[model samples]
Target: MNDKSKSVKFFEQLSWGIWIWSFIALLCVSIYLSVWAPLGNIAALLVTGISFAGFYSLSIKMRTTTKIEGQMLISNKAKIDLKFIKSATALDAEGFKRLAGVDADPAAFLAINFWSKTGVKVELKDKKDPTPYWLISSKDPKRLVKALVKAQK
Candidate 1:
């Protein structure tokens, strides 16, 4: 039987607050420019609208739920059930070599952001959910993969 405990990781809500604040700042800048700068009110409005849309997108992206259990990495939005992952296979030798160069372990798993370029991404077989699935980072990829493999059985 799989012995690993189930854990939930929710993205902090404070991140949403930050995005809201950024949007507000952008709006303020746009208003100021509209009143005092060469750009007309129409241009300012466009800039403000774009900034708001960008922040809105970021807010949506920041919200997510992660479930890690014996041999499975699940995301509620994506409805992904990644089964039978081997711990060693979680991070390949090349990834490990890269981490080693930075005094880091490839096994460590971290959440992915817009900036991250490396990590595993998987999609659920089901077609209901729209969010993409990921196994972005793992501190012990091999162990996690092994746990997943065992859980799948």
Candidate 2:
């Protein structure tokens, strides 16, 4: 859904697995109730449809989006200007685990999801800002890092 002008360099949605699992659980419950109460298949289908709509709304509330708009590094939780960033490191699954777990900074801005194992760690240059870095989850860490680096320049 991006235009040819390419103002946005990266975009990803986290926790899509929740959408799949929630729908399956709701459908199963609908079928189980149909077996016990003699409700027709049409009624079960209706219940399934209604549950899907509710779950869609809930997933939207839980989902986190990461995107770069112009020179801004943004997520559902927070956004920052690229000018304040010093460097961007693309982390693999293992590097991400270490930084997100054992080496995490208390003052860092975290826009991470457990389901996302690859990401970027953005070090901040602005001394006035208390935050040391930003930890962001991405489906493609390299692409995200590339975007952030380009924006910082």
Candidate 3:
């Protein structure tokens, strides 16, 4: 568990390798279009540059924003309070699949991304809240669970 008075932060982001490879592929396509297609050099460059910039910007914003702050779990799509969290457990790929598929609660909130093969399941304790739990995809599930548990204190 984490120190009761100390705040700990945990974050997850898209793999840089994935981003680089995607950019490379996009570059290749753009170059091919510029050289062979009727769009021409200037138009192709502008289109490709804009497209790449938009994609990269959105990806970075979305990926990097998923983080834990103090006792709050902050993601691009949701913010969760650790006080409302009863327990947190890390899940591997198969476990994630099973829980999300067969054992999923209809009232649970999910902020899952397929790029991550692991996740953390947080059971909610707040009876007043209709949400049963949360399933959040993570690049580092163990660390995330640890952080959540620590924050619980």
Best by lDDT: 2
Ranking according to TM-score, highest score first: 3, 2, 1
TM-score of each: 0.37, 0.76, 0.77
lDDT string, candidate 2, 1-153, tens digits: 345334877788887685677766867686658754787677776776776677778767878899888777888858888888889999999999999999999999988886788889999989899999999888888988887777666
lDDT of 3 at 73: 80
Least well predicted 10-residue stretch by lDDT in candidate 3? 1-10
Ranked by lDDT, the better of candidates 1 and 2 is 2
Candidate 2 residue pairs in clash (backbone atoms < 3 Å): none
Candidates in order have lDDT scores of: 0.48, 0.82, 0.76
Candidates 1 and 3, the one with greater lDDT: 3
Question: How do the residues 72-144 of candidate 3 rate in per-residue lDDT, one tens digit apiece?
Answer: 8876668877788888899989999988889999889887765667888988899899998888877788998
Model 2 stretches with alpha carbons more than 4 Å out = 1-6, 18-47
lDDT string, candidate 1, 98-132, tens digits: 54346443443335443232333332343454333
Query: Model 3 segments beyond 4 Å from truth?
Result: 1-6, 15-20, 23-36
Alpha carbon deviation, residue 106, candidate 3 (Å): 2.6
